[model samples]
Target: MSEKTNQPLRICMISYRSNPHSGGQGVYIRNLAKALCELGHEVDVLAGPPDPLLEGAARLIPVETLDLYNPEALFRTPRLDELKDPVNLMEWIGTSTMGYPEPFTFGFRAVRHLKDQLHKYDIIHDNQSLSYGIEKLSRKIPTVATIHHPMTVDRRLAVRSVRAPWKKFKHLRWYSFIGMQKRVSRKLPKIITVSEFSKKDIAREYAIDPSRFSVVPNGISTELFHPMPAIPREPGRLIVTNSADMPLKGLYHLLEALHRVSLTHSVRLTVIGKAKEKGGIEKLIKKLNIAHLIDFTGRIDHHQFVREYAKASIAVVPSLYEGFGLPVGEAMATATPVISTTGGALPEVAGDAALLVPPGNSNALAKAICSLLDDPEKRKQLGAAGYNRVHEHFTWKNAAEKTVETYREVIRDYR
Candidate 1:
C-alpha cells in the first residue's frame, strides 16, 4: 500500500454489543473511534444494542438484532415479523437453547449490511465478534479481528466454579459460541489482542500461530479517569470495580478477603458494580456475613465513577483473568493506590505501580489491602507512580495509532 493511500483510510468498526456502562468493549470502541477520527480518519461504528455513545464519529449505524438480553425485557420472544428473518430466527433458537446469540446474529446482520457497502471502506475491523458471518465478510473485504482473550478461559473458570451437574452443563451450553469464535479467528488474516498475555492465550486456545496476532494494549481514558486531587480521599475506604457475579472477575474471593480484613481493620468496601440477583456473589455475601460492611453501587456514570476512585484510599482488582484489566488502569489513572491480582494482563497493565496478589487468593488480597491501608506514605508514592505510568504508556492516541498500523498491514495483505 502506498504511504499516501494509507493516510486517512476509511474504516468500518464492528461491535456486537457496546454499551460503555455494560463493559470494557464499549469503552474500547468509543475511545478508539474518537481517537482515530482525530487522526484524520473517517470512522463508522456499526453496533447492536445497547448503543455505544460515540462523539465526533462519522456515523453510528445501528445494526438491529434480537436484543434478547435487554434487562428491561430479558428473554422476551421476538415478534413474528422479526422471526421471518433467518438471522433473527437463529438468535431466537440459540437464546432459547441457553446460548448467546449476539455474536453470531450480529455478524450475520453486519455482513449483510456490509456486503453492498464494501466499496466505501478500506478495511473492516471487528471488535471480538468472531462469528461465521464475519468469516464470510472477511472473504469479501480486508478484515481483521480483535479477540480480547479466548472465551474458552471464561468458560473453564465458570464451569469449574460451579459443581452442580446441570449448572455445569448449562455453562458449557452458554459458551457454545466459543467454537464459532475459534473457527472464525483462525480463518482471519490477522487478530489483534489487548495484551501479550491475551495474544498467547488466544493462540494456544484457538490453536492459531502466534505470528498471526498483534498485541495492542488498551488505553486508559485519562480525560475521565485522571486524578482528582481536590477531592479528599477517605481513609479505610477500599474500592473494587467489577461485575460481581462473573466468576472470572473473582468477586467472591474479594468478598472473602474483605471479611478477613474487616476483622482487624475498620475498612469499608465499596463495589462499583452490582452483583447478579441471587447469583453466587449474592449468596456468598450472605454466607460470609459481610453484607453490612460492603456497598454495591450498581452502575454509575463516568463522572461519578472517577469521583468514586478519587474518594477511595485504594483500589483492588480481584479478577481470575482479564484480557486487559481496565479497572486497574482506570484506578491508577485516578491516582489511587491499587492492589491487583497477577491475573492474565493485570500485571501487564499494573506493572509495578500497583501491589500484586495471586489470583483467587483472599489472604494475599487482604494482606495487600491492609499493607496499603496502613501506610499512607506508601499509598501516596504508589498513586503518583501509577499516574505517571498511565500518562507515559497508556493513551487512546497511542492505541489508535498502533491499531491503524495493523489496519494498513491487513489492507495491504488483502490486496
Candidate 2:
C-alpha cells in the first residue's frame, strides 16, 4: 500500500505452533518479531497450540487448535460452535483420517481473522505453514512465506531409516500433505528460505524456479546463546539438542557414537530434549549399556539450556537432514565447537569452522568426537571461529534487516 521507509511498519507474523520445544519455527518467530520491533516495526505474532515466551514490543495473538498431542486431554474436541464453519468441519475430519491438518486449519482461521482488517498491517508473513488458505490470503495482502526446508526431505530420510516396507508406506501416508504444501508454495509470489541449501532442495522438490526464492538465514539469540566465559566446561561432556523423536534427527546414531566413545574416553552425553520411554533412543541406550553414561534432561528453560551448553566441551548436531540447523548456529554462538553431519543445510551453517561428518555414520562421528576431545587447541580455534561466524552472519538484527528488505522488494513488485 505504501513505500517501505525508515518509518515503522505494522507487521503480522503467523505460525501454527510457537512453542520453543516444538521446533525451530517457534524460536524463529520469537526472535524475528523482537528483532523487527527493535528495528522500529510494529510486530504481532499470531500463533496456535503452544505459547511463545516473548518480551515487550512484540504482541502475541493466540489461535487455538485441538492439540491432539496435549498430554492432559489427548483426542479432545473443541466447542461445537467453534467448529460450525464448513471448512473447519472438513479440517477436523481431515486430521482424524490420517493426515496433519493444523497448517490448513490455521490458515483458514488466520485468513478469516485478518480478512476485515487487511489494511491494519503492511505485510503478512507465514512461517512454514504452507497451506492453501495461505494462498488465498496472498491475494488480499502482500504475503511472504518462510520455508525452513522441504518436508519431502524428511519423508525420504524417514523411509530410508525404517526396516519394514510397511513402515515406509506408513511414513509416506503421514507426509502426504506435502502435496498441498508443494501446490501452495508454488503459488506464493514471495518466499524467504533459511539457507541456500534449502533454497535448492525446495525449488527442486516443489518444481519452482530457483530465482523465485530468497535466502534469509535464521539467527541465533546471542543474548541467550552467547558463550559464558566464566563457567568452565566439564571434561568429556557432550551435548546434543533434539526437539522431536524422529529418525531424521539422527539422535540414535549419536547415542551409538557416545557408547563407543565411552570405551576409550570417560564421556557422558546430555540430551536437552525428551526421549520417549520406549523410543528408539532409549532402547539403544539400554542395549548399549550407556544408560548410565547418558543423561536425558527432557526439557529445560532457554537460559538453562544455554548454561548446559556452557558446561559442554562440545555440541553435536546429528541430524540426517536440516533445513537451517539452528542448533549448530546456537552452539557456535555459544563458542562451543560443533561436530555436525553433512546433512541438508548443516554444512552451509557450520561453514569451515566446525568439524563435519557424514550423516548416519556413527563410526565417523566417534572419530571426530575423539579428535576434538583430544585436541584442545583445535577446540579453541573452532569455538572462536564459530562465535565470530554467527556474530558476523547470523544475528537476529541482520536477519530481520534482510527479511525487511525482501518484504519491500516483494511489495514493490506486487504493487
Candidate 3:
C-alpha cells in the first residue's frame, strides 16, 4: 500500500446479481457495501436485478439487464423491441438455450453504464462477474475481482448429481459461463476471495497463480443476527437457509438425516427458503414420507431471519461445499448452536464451536443432531462459544479494514 494515500478512496463495486435479502451473495453485497461506507470510503455499488438494497452512505448504481431469471417471469422471451439491444438479445438467447448469461450480460451492461463514469472512481471491484467486459475495464482502470468460490465446484456437483446423460448435458450447458469467468479471472491484477480454502481452490481451478489472490473472510452482521435471549429455543426445532433443490446445498442429505432422527425422536426442520412446487425437493420429501416433519418459511426479512434463528434449537449448514460458510457464521452471530458438515471451508468457519459431520453422510449427520438434541447443556455451551468466536473474529469492521487494504494494494500496483 502507498503510505501517502491516506485519504478515503472513491470505490466502484460491481455484481451481476445481488439477490436482495436472500442468499450469501446478497448478504455479502449489503453488508460489505455498508461496512465500506462506514469506513469513510465513497462506495458506489453497480448491481443487477433484484436490487442489493444497500444501506448507509454507499450508493446503488442500478445496472439493468433483461433480468431473464427473475422468478416472477423466469426465462420469458424478450420482446422484439427489447431485443434491439445486442446485450438483451444475447441474454435471451443464452437463457433460451439453457445457459446462464447473466454475468456476461451484466458485465456488458455495467461496462457500458460505467464507461462515461470511469474517471470518477479510484478503483473498481468486480464481484465474480469475470466477464469479457470486466476484463476490458481492467485495461482502463485499476480493477479487482472477488471469486467467492470456484464455480467449477458448483458445476461439478450439479453434473454429478444427475444420472441421465441429457440432464448432465444441461448442467454443463448452464455452467458454460465458467469458461469465460476462468479466462477473465486471469487478466485481473488482483482477486479477492472469501476463504483460504476458496483462494487455493479458485487459484487452481481458474489456473491463476495464488500470488494474485487476497483472502478476506466475510463479515457476519451482528446486529441482524445477534442473540435474542428473550426468545426460548425450541427443542428439536432445526433451521437451515437454502433453496431445497440445489444439489450443492446438500439439503437432500439433511432431509435424510431428519428422517432418520425422526424415526427415534420427534424432530422438525424449518427451511428458511421455499421449494419449487413439485420440484425435486418436494418429490423427495414425499418419497421419504418426511413432508410432515419439515416446513418452509419462504422469503423473509432480516428481523424474521433473526427470530427464526433465535427460536431454533440449532442451525444447520449442509452445503457439500462453500467458499465461506455464511450460514454458520450467521447462526454463530445469533448465538445459535450449529451443526455443519466438514465440506469446503465450513470447518474453518465453525472452528471448534460447532459439531462437525462429513459431507453427504446422512448417518453421521443424524448421529450428530441426535447428540446435540439430547444434551441441552452441550448445545448451550456451543451456542455461547460460537457467539464469542464470531464477535472476536468475524465482524464487518475487521473485514472492511482488510478490504480497504486490498483496495489500496490494487491502487498502488496500478500506479
Candidate 4:
C-alpha cells in the first residue's frame, strides 16, 4: 500500500550506467527507487547503456550512447556517422586516448534527454555523474548528487596496484575525470552519501565542504536477503563477493587467508562473482593452488544468492575500503555471521554483530575464520545478532525516508 504523502514528489534519478549485476551503483538504483515509490513518489531513472531493472511504480528512461565500453564490444570503434554527434565523437576520442569519458558525455546526453521534461521532476538526483553538464542542470532545477565515495581512492589504489610505468600512466589517465567531478559537486546545493566515513573522505579528497553532505546509509534488501531457515548450513563454508583484480577489494588478502585456513581446516569458498580472463585473481588462485577449494558463481539471481548465504557457514567482506559495506549488511540480513575488516565504513556497518579484523591482514582474517568455524554456537549467535541488527537499523524504507528528507531540504533551499 502506498503511503500517500500530502504532496507526491516527481524525482529524476540519473545514473550514467546501471547494469543490475555489475556493482553497487546498480543495486543502489534498483532498491532505492522502489523504496521511494512505496513512499508515494514517482521516480524515473534516467540511465545510459546496460539498462537498470526497476521494481514498484518507478520507471526507467534510457538515453542511448556509443557505449564503447560495452562488455559485449568493449572499446569498439564507432562508425563515421555514429561519431558525427559531438557527444559521441568526444566519448570515442576520450576512450581511444585511455580515459573514461562516459560520465562527462553521459551528462550532455542526459541534458539533451531531459531538456523537454525539465519541469516534470521536483528534484534531479545524480548517481555519481558529477559532470559539467550536470552542473548546468543544478542551476536550472533543484539538484542533489550522491557520491558513493571518493573515486580518488580507487584511482590511487589502482595506480599503486600496477607495476609497469605505462600501466600506471593509463590508470592515472582513466581517473582524470575526477577533476571535473570535484568542480561540479561543489556547486550542488546538497549531497547524499552512504556513510559519515565517506562524507569526511570525499570532502577531504574532493575539497567540498563537509556541511554539504548528509550521510544517509544504504539499506539491505531484506525480502531478498533474509534467512532461509529450511536450507541447512554447510560446515566450514565461506562466501565472498568478488570484484575481480581490483586491489582495493582486498580479495588478494582474502585468498591468502583462505589458503591459510585450508591448511588447518576443511574449508571451501564460494565467490559470488567471476574472475576475469588471465586477470590477477585467476592467476592468484593457481598460485595458491586453492582452485579446487573455491567455487565461482559467475552470475546469480536473488534466489541463488539467498540459497548460497543460507548454506554458508560464514560470509566475509575483506575490502580495504568501502563507501558503505553492502556485503556486510547482506550477510547479516541473511542471518549469516560476518567477518569484515576495519576498512572504511565496514565497522560502521558491522557494528558488534560480527568479527572485525584489520584491512589487508591475511593472518587476522584466517584467525577470525578459524575461530568462527570451530565455534558453531558463536556463529549462530552472531548470525542472529546480525539479522536483528539489519532489521532494526538498515531497511530501504528508512533509507528512502531519510533520502526524501534531503530531497525536501534541497527543494526548499533552491535559489
Candidate 5:
C-alpha cells in the first residue's frame, strides 16, 4: 500500500528527551510516527533519555546518555568500564560546567549510528535537537527539522521570571543552546513547525528565511481525547492542563483570574499539572487565599485527564505562548468549551471556536469565565463549534500524509 515515492524512504525521527508523561515533543513523535507507519511508510525513532511511548511496528532506537536530570539519582555514577573513553570524561566535564552538552552528544551518537546505516534511510528528520553535530548529518543525508517554537521565548520568559539577578544570569547561561540552534537553523534546507506564528517567530529569532519553514499544525488524538458520555459533567468547575510552575505557562495569571472569579462566583479551578512545592503557583494561591478553591491533579493518565476534561463545564488555556496548544484541541475533542488566550500560536489553534482573550490579562480571563459560567447555551455552542473545528482541520492522518509528502520532497531534492 506504499504510494509510489521516487524511492522508499527509511525515515528516522530524533528527540532529545522523549518522555510522553512529561512534555509535548515526545507525544508528537510517538503519534506522528505511528500515523506515518499506518500509511505504509517505514519509520524509526532515535531518542535520548526518558524513552518514547511509541505504538506498533515503529522501531524505537534509544541512544543512552547520562540522564543527568534523573530526580532520584542526580549525578549518575559512571562505571569504570564506561569511563574508559576520554570523550565520555570530556562530556561529563562539559555537563558539570552547566553547559547543555546532551543535544550535541546525542547528535554525535546519532551520526555514528547512521554511519553504518546511512544507505538505509533516504532522509533524516530531526525533532528540534539542533546541534552542530546535527548539521554534520545534513551534509551526508537530506535532513528536515521540526522546530515546535523558538526556545528563546522560554529563555526570555525564564529570565524575566527570576527575581534575583544571579538567577537570571544563570538562566541566560543555561539557555546558551539557542546560539547553536540559531546557527544550525539557517543552514537547514527545510524546517517544519506547528503554526504560522511559530514560522515567523523562528524566522526572526534564528535569522532564517521564513519561506524555508513549513507550517504543519499538530493533530489531536481524537480517539483518546473524545468525550466520555458516561462521565457526568461537573458544574462550575474549570479545567486547565498547563505546567503550573513554569512562568511561560501563565499559571500565575490563571490563578489571579481564578481569585477574582471566586469573589462572586462559587467556582473551582482544576489544574492538571502539579504546582511544585514552594513554587510560584503555590505561593500565589496562598497569597490570593484561593487555595481552597483550586485543585491540582499532578500528572494523571490520559484516560483520567480526558475524563476530567469531559466532566468540566469549561477548559481554560492561559499560556503566555504556545507553538501549538494541544490542550485546546484535546478539550475541544471532548466537546468542552474553551477559553484561551491569544498568546503566540494559541489563536491559531483555538480559532473562532473558543473565546479568545489577551494574554496576561486576568480581568479579561475572569470575564470570559463568568460569561461561560452564566450561559449554558453559549457553552454548548462553543463546545460543538470547537469539536467541529478540530474534526475538520486537525487530524493525525492528515499530518502523517503531509509529513510523508515532505519526506518524498526532501529525498527527491537530495538526489
Candidate 6:
C-alpha cells in the first residue's frame, strides 16, 4: 500500500452514462472532477456514451458500450461482431426486453479494464453504478459509491403516474436493474449521498445501516450559473428545468399551474427541455389548451442555460421528488428567486431561500408564482438570500474537499 504524504492521490471515478445534456449525473461528474483536480489531486473519469464534458486536471477514459439507447439510432440492432462480447450481448438482450442494462454492462466492462491496472490508483469512486461488478471490484480495491437517490423512488412514481396495467408493467420491466442496485448497495462499505434526506431514504429503502453513508451536498458551478446582470429579467415569464415527461420531475403539475396562472395573468412559460411527441407532457399540454403559452427550449448549452435563468422572472422546481435538487441550487446560484416543492431534499437545498409549495399541487404552485411576480421586492429579497445561501453552503470546492476526506478514510481503512 502507498503511504499518505503531501503528494496528491491518484483517483479513478466511474459513471455508466455521463452526458451533461442528458441529466445532472454528467454535470456532477464534470464539476466534481474539476474541483478535485483544483485541489491538487489527480482525477480520471471513466464513462460510457454519451461522453462527459470534463476540464481542468481530469482525464476522461471512454468505456465503450453497445450504446443501444443513442437517440440517433433509437434501438438499432448491434452488429454481430459486437455481440461476440457477452456483456454486449446481455446489453442488447436487456434493451430488447425493455430493461435498462447500462449499469450492469458498464460495470462489467469497467471492472475488467481496471482489474489489470488496479495498482494505478489509490481509490475508486463510483457514481451510482451499483452493479454486481462493482461489488466484485470493491472486494479487491477500496471502493465507494454515490447513490443519488434510490431508483425505487423513480419506479414507484413512474408506476403510479400511469393508470394502465401494461404501462405499469413496462415501468416495472424498465427498472428491473434496481434489484441489482439494491443488492450491491448493501455490500458496499461506504456510500455517499447528496443530502440528509437522501441518506435516510436510501438507508431505509436499501435496508442498509445509516452509518454506511455520508451526506455530502452537491454544489452548483457558480462560475457558470452566477447572475448575468446584463440580461434583463423578463416580467411574467416563468421558467422551469424539468425532464419533460418524467413523473418524478412533476412537470405535469407545473403545466397545470401554468394553465391556471395564465387564465388571469399574462404569464408565459419556457421549459428548458423537450417533450416527447406523444408523451404524457405533450398530451397534457394539448388537453389543458396551453400549447401556445409555453416554449420548450429542447437542450441548450450551459451558457444559454445560465442566461435563460437570468432572463426569467422566477425559476420553478416542481419536482415530485429529488435526490439533491441540482436545478434549485443552480437557479438560486443564478440569483433567481425559486418556487420549489418541498419534495425530497428540495427544501434542504432551498433552505429559506425559496417559496415552498406542496408537491403535485398546481393551485399552490400557481399562487406562489403569481405572488412572486406581483412583488418585485420579494423576488429581489429571495434572490439575494438564495445567492448567499449557495455561496455559504454549496460550492464545488467544499464538496470536493469533503469527498476527498471520505476517499482518504476509505483508503486508510482498506489498507
What TM-score quantifies how close candidate 6 is to the native fold? Answer: 0.98
Off by over 4 Å in 5: 1-7, 74-91
Report the error of model 2 at residue 296, Å: 0.7
Output the better candidate (2/3) by lDDT: 3
Estimated TM-score per prediction?
Answer: 0.98, 0.95, 0.98, 0.97, 0.95, 0.98
lDDT of residue 354 for candidate 4:
94
Candidate 4, residues 290-361: lDDT per residue as tens digits? 999999998888799789999999999999999999999999999999999999999889999999999989
Residue lDDT tens for model 3, 72-94: 99778778999999999988888
**How well does candidate 6 score on lDDT at residue 134?**
89
Candidate 5, residues 36-123, lDDT tens digits: the string is 8887778889887786878867898888776776666877767777667655665676667776667767777787777788777767
The runs of at least 3 residues in candidate 2 whose Cα sits more than 4 Å from the true structure, single-residue gaps closed, are 4-6, 77-88
Q: What TM-score does model 2 achieve against the real structure? A: 0.95
Better of 2 and 4 by lDDT: 4
| lDDT (Cα, tens digit) per residue for candidate 1, span 320-407 | 9999999999999999999999999999999999999999999999999888888999999999999999999999999999999999
lDDT of 2 by residue, 215-312 (tens): 99998888888888899999899999883569889998898899889899999988887788787777777789888887778767778888899999
Candidate 5 accuracy as lDDT: 0.85
Quote model 4's TM-score.
Answer: 0.97
* lDDT minimum window of 10 residues, candidate 6: 1-10
Shift in Å, residue 327, candidate 1? 0.6
